[model samples]
Target chain A: MDPTEREVACFEAGIKFGTLYHQFAGTPVSPESAASLERAMEAAVENQPHCTAVDVAILVDELDTTHDYTELTGRYMEVHMRIDYGETVVRTEMRMEDGYPMMRVVDVHEE
Target chain B: MDPTEREVACFEAGIKFGTLYHQFAGTPVSPESAASLERAMEAAVENQPHCTAVDVAILVDELDTTHDYTELTGRYMEVHMRIDYGETVVRTEMRMEDGYPMMRVVDVHEE
Candidate 1:
């Protein structure tokens, strides 16, 4: 099936976030990195058949880079995702772990 | 100095294209893929100080995937890029070569 508008928008947002993250982190967002992020989003809602949108944003003000710069220091990010199948909304915080973006759910509201 | 609006837009476009390319190619746009594209863009106008924007578009109608799908078959793409420095505009055709996006100048006009 052709992807929905929301799906396309969500995917586009993912791309934007990937670029923004690399820009602030002083790293370049490579295609590999983007694929990793796409996999993460898929994993996030793997079981949800109706999941349509996934949005990720950086809390720029909350970003902290005080750790050793020589090593990869995972930073916090804000995520708001939507699952249309169940009218579900997921709000969470996430960070990179071992070079992978991981999320911790803060809220899941079902409408 | 802060990045120019055009720079940010170009970078964002790069991200979008990376995703779009993978979506169509059935492969994945990785961090490495994005980085390589960025490098190619840099190389395109490295000497130009006022270069600002780069845009990429897929020639969906021209896309011919009749070849072996298992292998990376580089496809042609349409590109319109701008360099504000010399008031330049770059219109070209590009494709993936050896797993990297490569461009060939079709037209370069300064206004």
Candidate 2:
């Protein structure tokens, strides 16, 4: 079955964020693109009106690989991403090196 | 005093990582840019010969703001980044919405 509208909206928001983030990393973008990005972001927030209540985090290791490039050699980060959720917060981290994603419940009192 | 070469290297690596990360995030780049990014990655690894020994994680909430763009409105994530360290792992999370970054030692003994 297809994803629900809200689910699709959330996924789109993530993609839009990722797109704009990279697009504007060290350069300027056209005002038109910026506007589109802004609209997407707003839609995302609206889709997750209660995102403030979820909290999450993820960690991973031994997930990157080092390859030798004939002209240029280096390691590519293949980290993992994690998420933590709770009564009033939502946290998400992606560890690209590892292939799996994790979700957890947070304990705020200990800290 | 100015940052040491090694420290500078670390900072540069972070920057380069961010740069390449955003640059090649969704779109492909020229072979030249790709090669340069690869070289920088290798240099970063050489600089962090012992990153495998550190562990860290960061969590934050109450970040992001919505602004009116006239033409389009959306929220921007101004999160904080937290780092967790340990004997064999290093975990870092950027909470863009929050203003502060955090660091902690992992308690792997728990599930």
| Cα-based lDDT for every prediction | 0.41, 0.26
| lDDT: worst 10-residue window of model 2 chain A | A68-77
Residue-level lDDT tens digits of model 1 in A1-111: 997654553444344334334422322223223334333333333222343545544333443334311111235444555444334454444566776776555555556
Question: What lDDT score is found at residue A110 in candidate 2?
Answer: 11
TM per prediction: 0.34, 0.24
Write model 1 residue lDDT over B1-111, tens digit each, in one string.
986654453444345344334433422223223333333333323222333545544333444435311211245444455444334454444566776676555555557
Q: Report the Cα lDDT for residue B3, model 2.
A: 27
DockQ, each predicted model: 0.06, 0.04
Question: B43-69, model 2: which lDDT tens digit per residue?
Answer: 443343233221111111221113211
Candidate 1 global TM-score = 0.34
The C-alpha local distance difference test score for the whole of candidate 2 amounts to 0.26
What TM-score does structure 2 among the candidates reach? 0.24
- Label model 1 with its docking quality class: incorrect
